[model samples]
Target chain A: MINFTILENYFPVINKDIIIGNYTFYIKLYQDKNGYFSLEVDISKKDTKEKHRFVQFLLGLGKDEPNELSCHDSEVPHFKIDYYQREEEAFSATIYFTFRNIAEEELIDYAKGTVVIITKMLRKYFENEDIDIANLSEVVYENSVISELLDYEEKVIDAFYICWKEGDLIVRQKGKDNFVIKTKHNLIKYLNFDYLKPIYLPLKEKIEINEKINSSSQIM
Target chain B: METELDKIQTTITIPLGLKNRIRKLKGSMTYKQYLSKLLRDRNKLAHNESYIEIQNLVRKSAVYSFGYYKVTFTYNEYNNSENFIFDIDIVEIRNKGALESIEKFKKNMLGSEKLQSYQELILTHKLYFELLEKAIQIEIEPLFSHKSRMDDYDAWKKEFESLGLSKKSFDFDVMRKLRTLENQGDAF
Candidate 1:
């Protein structure tokens, strides 16, 4: 089984254009041994109307074959969208897929293709005039900080995990930096890393130490 | 995205044996003229949206009629840093059924005939590599340099790094191994 999570913060609002609201976007994907894969997307509840519209747009697109390959419900497919209100707001959607004797390479290809399609849909939604295109790009480009860690020379690192804490998303760079960025309701309009933490070697060493301690405890 | 026209040019002398072969071929042209023609043909093909069609056209061009060649150069950048990379790859476009033809040709030829043809083809390889090396030096090298803005790299690197895990210890070897195994497909 494999699990992947993406967290985005600091959405942008421009020129009082379109709707003025704060938003958070989270997407999770999981694949199980039983040849089943699931995708979950969570957005702020305040943006429920827009989220619902986005969902409907996806459903419409899915119904229409945009590329050479299209997804249909009959083959290892099921999906659900859930909405909830917290102190802020959130929207959640999940997609499950059951594979049919497919090779791992095929599964990986499907996952990559699905990610591209979903991202394209979101980009279209955010860029549509009905939605704030400029602000959407700004928010996504600015607040989506995870790309930095991912692009690190593949020789240096492999993967990353993010955690939410104290209303802020804390980025623990697996072995290096642990940066805690304060959440903003508005789209991220400005980004300056002057005060951000630069936890590199020290955090990695600490993680190594902790692992050793945990293993020792298990033996004891 | 304005194409930079200023290029530093360099030339390397071709060996007499290869030059002699070029002289013997009908409709033969100088290396530079041949390359210029190839580039012109490639440009026309590239503008066409269909890659497969472009591939076909490229095979019919002078580059293929003569032989294969490779052109390599660093792209434009600032601060003396080579930021961009460019290559003008030219390869011989064989007839659609050339591979099968070559196999048949090899089968029909006796020992001495096969030896002579193989020896002659080596000269073609040498000329192709030489033309490729020189074209890149003259046409492509000048455009490459460091990007104008310092913040670009930092911001790009930051955004790039953010896309994956930051820790150095994460083991992606499994993912790579899985891909390799999948590619090998029961061979292992």
Candidate 2:
């Protein structure tokens, strides 16, 4: 096997979240062969109508410098939303969620956390009514996805974050104009999130959720 | 006239290995100086009988349709000189049915507005080999011819300069030629 440790070393630690309507939901990271590092959240049939509404909420988190957001409904049973940044290089995060067994309220509550919100949106899109949540057992990570993430991580370290002053704000409110709004949001902004440093989080805690899923699989 | 020329030029049958060694040794020498030295060496050790001459070297571009090879010579050269020439030929290899499928491919390709020039195609195929041979001849031949003058950097520099070539200029010329060639096909 080709040693992909070099590639895996560069992936930014994505702390993902999902939101359905008003609530945040759970999600799982899946590496796809087409160089997509996807977050999937599985929900139930009742929350199907809120799929577009949930995606709109994600769009509201808005964009940070160097990040572009786009949505596609080109696939059946799932809506694919992609967030990408292209400059001298590119970084992208795609969320695939399928609406399954979970409620819309639970998904909305889950969206309070960044990781949970992203996960809930993905779960609602990727899961089909025919697919059993219990049967989706295999966790496969593509080598290309791992390599791409590693490349993105290196670029993130090398690039200086673009800082914007209040003068650059597009919205000029007459009363609150003086307030210096320096906002960094989205995947690019999350590069600064404190939980990302692998050294701070012990390996045991890092694998906590993954281990739980694995153990639960064994019990089933 | 041919009989008189044959009588004047003595047939020298040197071993292939010896000839190769001499060729390698004469690598840093000028062609004139190398030939002179080789003549002297041949006269001193001229006892061999069997002689083999490489009359010609031809490079052909062959188009295979289905299973048959339809070959046509693209380039040919004949060498009647005493010394053997070692010019490397590099050819591009395609699939067996490439020519037969060309009409279909051309139809698809012509739909695109951009077309490649013939000069560009030829240069892209030939430039590396040309550079390699020229560099080897200029740099290596003189040193082989004169062992005593091995450290003569000035001589090597003069030869290199005399070639009147630069990597940048060569690349530019190739691109320019390619552009001209590409335009020719469209005009016709």
Candidate 3:
């Protein structure tokens, strides 16, 4: 039997929660399973919807910096830290860091140091997510009830979105403030052009309650 | 009359010892043929002829798609480059996304810290050899494959650089972030 000291000693992976700048950062490690085990670190907030998106936006802002990393070493230090960028979902965001390949023996004397350095690097950018979070307020989605935007514009409707399908918001025409609305159940008919305060929490609850009421009456 | 594509001339200098070493292994290949063949097989020597790692700095693309066999290193602007070379089958890691492939290009202009470029060449003494693993695995052809590079290649670069990681800075930020793992180590 092989005596393993660390979790990564057997397999190649490191994942956990890190506390820096008074905020808990959820990070996970993915190592290449093929030749020289390359590693990637993903950082995000926990539980909140912004957890997914919080890191992606922050990384997007720093994509232009000159800190691209890669490792030329082959043994254990065979890893280099590459680039950082955003991984975006429909409503979630995450940021991750890529390293070139690194060997396992590096952990004998260097693994702990490497892990500490990476954490310090993460803390250095604590201000990356320095944007004001808008209170969970009313939101207006003309379609699928999955998204809740913190902010948007009303100058012109550019496109309509559904789960997997989308159409042009409107044809680009000079001096045209009017556009057609397309959807099976569009609130556009019942909505004022200027009043757009409809978010999903209240809307979804209303739908659920109505369905329950209709079912009760039918059973009665 | 020989056509332009038929023959081309270029000068290369090599130590006499290295040349004799290559000649003993060349067998019947002409000097020109040997030089061309040597360039093509330059990557295998890195790890003593087991695998070849192809990393193109220009496109920021990297691939380890060869075994201990006759390999080809074709550098072209378009196309995947080496498709005709037989006796070698390999898989490629598909996460070569660029966070800003041009960061080094910009740094070169801004006159930042000293920049280092990495280059690995492969060379082989023999032409081809059957992989012992192939017979054990009962496989016939090499499959071009891709593995997950990271959570997100581009996103990782952005966060890493935003922390001000230059060779000169030597700040704790670069060290911590680079070495840090999620909730790993004896902590767990």
Candidate 4:
């Protein structure tokens, strides 16, 4: 009973065959069982095991520039695209556009525009060999670390001042403990080992140590 | 010492049908994991009054075997005369298998979609209740007194007949009732 008139009209008119530079893709747009818009992009070439790498690379690009390819109102990009192996021939990929904000009028434009952008990104990825797939995992890990750090605040540990506030880390000089610098960057920015020497301790031990330091400072 | 304990095995002799049912329900999970999950469900059931009533009633009607762990499950044969005895080592209606089956059914019903229609929600609630009822009948009914057993059957029959559902659609009526209550902001 759901309306598919807009979706049906759009896909056929656009012609499933899409040519982006050297790459040719056969894109089929439809609604999946859960009633979400899904775009299945099949690589024209029979040998797509190599081409699946480009799809992963596109996902990596989306993560890097989330603002461009992010879900409706979310800060993080939609990462539901799955590429499954089809026999011994090729790999087929499906990307779901699960945005609640997408309108009927904008459906065609959104799907087409996204496809074009993604295709262009894939083409660029194929041209460049510098972008390693491993770097994508690293970027994802770094973002998660930043998110986890943002949840808690550590005021003073040892002689250094450290606190995470509003996606920025505020830290003071290690040995000098004089100058305070706040930066909106990865933990690596201050993890140089020169400015700050990071120590590994159990949370219970750290809390006990902090309490002891607080009591000593109060007495002094 | 721990490794030696891990090598210990316990024998469980149950009704062939019940064993088959357990095997089907415990898909992709080991027996220990399934039992552990069931124990969690049983602990959760402590907070639910109606489900506790069903469980308690089954326990009260049955006679416990002394010394060795022997429990009875009555499956009425042909003329509702013969009792099917399940010689299980464990305690209380073999709830581990039953609970895991219920959880599996629930997951399958609510697969991916977060939003469900009134009828769909009702159906899901009813199906789970019926599953529990079936489990009770299979694993605990044999030990039930004739009067007690008839009373339970009549109670379920009256409830279903009130909702205008056939015996085959037993689970559906429960679903509609639960769904209606849930939508009206009543605890289901």
Q: Which prediction has the highest TM-score against the true structure?
A: 3
Q: List DockQ for all candidates.
A: 0.01, 0.01, 0.02, 0.02
lDDT of 4 by residue, A22-119 (tens): 33344344544434444433332223344212221112101111121111222221222333232212222222222333344444444433343333
TM-score of each: 0.20, 0.16, 0.23, 0.22
**Interface RMSD (Cα, Å) for model 4:** 26.0
The prediction achieving the highest DockQ against the true structure is 3
**What lDDT tens digits, residue by residue, belong to model 3 across residues A131-166?**
222211111111211222112211001111121023
Docking class of 2: incorrect
Candidate 1 regions with alpha-carbon error over 4 angstroms = A1-24, A31-36, A40-101, A134-220, B1-188
Worst 10 residues of 3 chain B by lDDT: B119-128
Residue A162 alpha-carbon offset, candidate 2, angstroms: 84
Residue lDDT tens for model 1, B87-130? 12232223333532333333333333544544334333333334
- Relative to the unseen true structure, what is the Cα RMSD of model 2? 29.0
Task: Report the lDDT tens digits of candidate 2 across residue range B1-188.
Answer: 23665456455675565567667778889645798785665453232111111122333232222224231212222222222122222233233434423333333434555645553344333433333333343433323221223224344334333433322122222322233233342100
Ranking by lDDT: 4, 2, 1, 3
Error of 4 at B187 (Å): 54
| Best prediction by lDDT | 4
Worst 10-residue lDDT window, candidate 4 chain A: A56-65
